[model samples]
Target: MTRHPVLEARNLRLQFGGVTAADDASLSIAAGERVAIIGPNGAGKTTFVNICTGYLKPQSGSVRFEGREITGVTPREIVRNGIGRSFQLPQLFLDTTVLDNLLLALAAREGIWNTWTPLKRHPRRDEMLDLLEVIGLTETAHQLPRELPEGMRKLVDIAMALALRPRLIFMNEPTSGVSTREKFAIMDVVIRALQHNATTAVFVEHDMEVVSRYADRVAVWSFGRIGLEGTPAEVLNDPDVRRGVVGS
Candidate 1:
């Protein structure tokens, strides 16, 4: 049986007045693939993710998830159709405990009306706890976001995104703003969690080492378009990518 790409964006063009945020850019990611998008700052990596996830609309072209056009769909609707994303900065409820944060995401995922129901009493609370264990954050579930370390907070944001049960998840700079020592450990947890859920991942990454370690394939975004696409060995080793994108 033939299977369509899990997500495909073709010939996308979005202009921001004089600057082109996405200039005739396109990409297709297969199911179960870990694709790392590499580029310098301002290279339109996030623009592609925003377009696909319905946070930003493109002036021209199409975004298809499972062969259905999702261009201009609301972000929530996109998520419903099996897509999710995490931002560069950890987006967490600083006032709430880690467990509650995921419970909220689970409520949102299942659309639970909980005005009268306590979150801990939700039927899916066990699932949330299991998720916490999967990400190795079970011990910290009672801690508030402000009380957790930055890396744990990042994992919580990722766990919330996973609560959506998306077939595909876009992670913006998954390793950015963390210490070098923590990057690999964080990525290990994330990739393991994704594999556990059978989810595909597309991450915008500036760290070449992280990309090389985690990505099955690499896409080099330059000047609002994809400059190269191939295995990490192929794309990461190219002269241009090494010089301009990798800055090594």
Candidate 2:
């Protein structure tokens, strides 16, 4: 039997002012796979994500989710299509409580806005709270984003993405700006939590330790294209991957 890819990008190309952000990049991730996209800065890692999540349109290429081509779909529509994404910098409602941030995400997914006031009695509130616990932020659920540490803030942002009940998620630099000491701790909790939820994850990360720990597969991007793809050990240990793409 042929296994269908849950996420697939084919010959993707994107350019901004003569700078190619994504150039003919292509890769496929099966359902339940945890893949890491890694490279140094300007590797077009984030740009690849932007195109995948519909935040940026490629000049030419195709993005397919579960057999359906979704090229050029709007971000909102992309979320509706069962793919969620998190930004590099934790994007959160700074003044909103952790619970409120998730609640807003739920409401947005359901497309129910009062226009004059917040809706009460969302059936998914309890579900959202459960997600908070999974992300290890249940104790601070009532606190505002500003009151939480950087790691917790990232958790909240991920929880918001999970609130949408996506089948696959694209996370951009999940550990960026976190204290070095907290990096592994945060990742352990996040990966374990997502596994418990049966969520498929793809993240762009710089930390090789974190990537080695969490990624089932690794894709190395360089010069705005995919340079290597294999298991973590396979890809990371490849001399070409090390000296040419990652080390460059």
Candidate 3:
């Protein structure tokens, strides 16, 4: 028997004025696979992620999740179809406590947006607390985003995405904006949480170390298309990737 890919894009094309963001882009991600998208800046990695996750409408092509076409769907519809994504910047409520931020996410997942309701009494409060613990932010749950370090903020964003109980999650530069000393630590926590939930992940990352350590497969984008797709060793060590992507 054949298992279908969790997400698949075929012959995607997108453009902005004179710039072609995606050109004949195609890929498939199986369930539970950790796929990394890496490329030089402006190579359209983020654009492709946006298109796949329904944040951008491609000029042409199709996207399928679990064998059903989802191209041109709304972002919220995609989320409802079991896709979640975190941005390069932490998309958090800066004024709210970490716990409140997650509680809000849980509420959004449940289609409850009554902001007047007491979050502490929400039916899913315990689930939100468990997510905080999973992200290693239990002790700082009451702290505002401003009080938390960059790494913790990133984790909280990821937690909010996870609260949706997505089958596949896209993380755009999860390690960006954090100190080098904290990158691995942040990744460790994020990866552990993903594993605990048995979620499939696709991440856009610039750090070769992060890709090497965490990716099950890698796709390198160049000239608005996938130039290489293989294991970390195959993609990272390719002469073209070193020169074109790594700039070595």
Best by TM-score: 1
Q: Give the residue spans of candidate 2 off by over 4 A.
A: 114-120, 244-248
| Clashing residue pairs, backbone N/CA/C < 3 A, model 1 | none
The TM-score between candidate 3 and the true structure equals: 0.96
Q: Write candidate 1's Cα lDDT for 97-176 as tens digits.
A: 99999999999988876588888898879999999999899999999999988888889999999988999999999888
Tens digit per residue, CA lDDT, model 3, 1-248 = 54568999999999999999999999999998999999999999999999988999999999999888999999999999999999898999998899999988898888775777687678879999998988899999999998988888889999999999999999999999899989999999999999988999999999999999999999999878999999999999999999988878
Candidates sorted by TM-score, best first: 1, 3, 2
Of models 1 and 3, which has the larger TM-score? 1
| Better-scoring candidate (TM-score), 1 or 2 | 1
Candidate no. 1 TM-score: 0.97
Native-to-model Cα distance after best TM-score fit, residue 59 in candidate 3, in Å: 0.9
List CA RMSD, all candidates.
Answer: 1.3, 2.0, 1.5
Query: Global lDDT of each model?
Result: 0.92, 0.86, 0.92
**Error of model 1, residue 161, in angstroms:** 0.6
Off by over 4 Å in 3: 1-3, 113-117
Ten consecutive residues with minimal summed lDDT in candidate 1? 1-10
Candidate 1's error at 203, in angstroms?
0.2
